[model samples]
Target: MSRAEELKQQLKPGQVYRREDLTPYSNAVDRHLAQLVTEGVLDKIAQGMYYYPKQSVFGVIPPEDEVLVRSFLKDDRFLLTSPNSYNALRVGTTQLYNKRVVYNHKRHGEVDLNGKKFFFCKTPYFPKKATPEFLLVDLVNHLDSLAEDREMVLKNVIVKAKSMDSNKLKYAVRAYGHTKTKKLLDPVLVQMKSKAHVH
Candidate 1:
């Protein structure tokens, strides 16, 4: 089979890939990619990432945030946290916040993927502590498309907290300290505690 055909078969919508990923299939991936670019069959989203131009109807195709998130994950193990978790809670629709994608990484600082922005917060913990308030606010944002029972979701959050490594959680709490996020979480925490007691 042609190198182009093989690459085409490997491509999936909303999936991010690197040029190196194509190496196993064909050594001519770069040449095939160059040819596709000249033909307007593919468009580069970043250094090594490309997307099929035809799949974009308006010719206004943009980089997929989730794809970028996955790319960031490839570099290091990260937990989707803060603004990102909040964004996911409101799943079906786009996030309203102006902030970039947030992740709890083993490393520190921020990295931009393609045109999308990602922030990596260093956390000593594996399963990080996500306060109820923050989680709820994110849930409220995505309430329109939620598939899980509200009670079940709330229970899961508490369970997650209980299962978290306490030392790591403490380290994260110290690293982040108190801020707007914690302030925002206050009421939600109260409500969750109240609900748990009632049930």
Candidate 2:
């Protein structure tokens, strides 16, 4: 088999790859990649990023957001979320956002990957999954950015928080919440504890 065919066989559909990943297969990497792009076998998404498009009845399916972002970051230690997710928490938020946010220790600010805009927030920590309490705290952290009424959202957050698992909520606040989130939730969490003891 030719070098192009070897490299093509190695690439899975709907997966992203950096040029460095193709290095072992061919020394004329750029020429080979250009040939593949011209042949419609690969699509270059960004600098040093190429994607193997997956075909479907409708047409080509873009790579999964997590897969694309992880390949771009070259790390899986990032949290993928959107401000729109706050609506699911029933915190009175209703606006849908076009951007996805990635919280990671490595990068900060907006980055364009594969034509999709992502806001990378540099943070010391992030959870693998979105927990109820974590979502509440994250909502408060980014409250000023939301399109909903601030007072109404805050009220709903407090109401919903009181009914959540006190232990898990406390853990989320300490583990994931920032200074403002911790300060805001501390008093309410104290009250929750006091109420629990009395009951």
Candidate 3:
């Protein structure tokens, strides 16, 4: 196969690639990339970023948020979430938000990737995956940004906190909570611990 053909052959569907990643496959990487994009072999999602479109019965599946962010940041250590996920806690959060939040060690502020917006938060700590307890702590951390009734949400949060594993929730509070969140949740967790001991 020609150098350009070999370059195209290296692409796999449902994957995102940085320009540097494909450079080794072709000497004339830019010309090859431009041709591939024009031929619909790839989509230029952003500068220096390309995605090989994956097809399904539903048409082309957009690059996954995980893949997109992972490539954009060039770092795999990121937690992608949004306020919309808070609704799963059933703590009176019903609003659906379009915002996608990324917690990572690098990149802070909003960025656009493939026509979607991601707000990158550089945090010192974030679990590889979010646990329910972690989400509770995060909810309180970002309460000010939420559109729901704050007082009502707090009331429900306290009640929900009671039903969760006291030890796990307490650790989450200490590790992930803001000063105010930690203060609000500590007393409740202590009460639960004491009550459990009493029984």
Best by lDDT: 3
Estimate every model's Cα lDDT from 0 to 1: 0.55, 0.90, 0.93
The better candidate by TM-score, 1 or 3, is: 3
Error of 1 at 102 (Å): 2.9
Clashing pairs in 3: none
Off by over 4 Å in 3: none
* Model 3 lowest lDDT segment of ten: 1-10
Which residue ranges in model 1 land beyond 4 Å of their true spot? 52-63, 75-77, 81-97, 126-199
lDDT by residue for model 3 (92-136), tens: 999999999999999999998999999999999888998999999
lDDT tens per residue, model 2, 42-140: 999989889999999999999899988899889999999999888889979999999899998898999888889999998888898887778998998
- Cα lDDT of model 1 by residue, 1-199, tens digit: 7778777777665566677776786678889888767776677667876765335665545555655666645664555554445534433333455455344555567776666556666654433345543354445433444455645555554444444444443344334535543443344455555665798
Assess candidate 3 and give its lDDT: 0.93
Q: Worst lDDT window (10 residues) for model 1?
A: 86-95
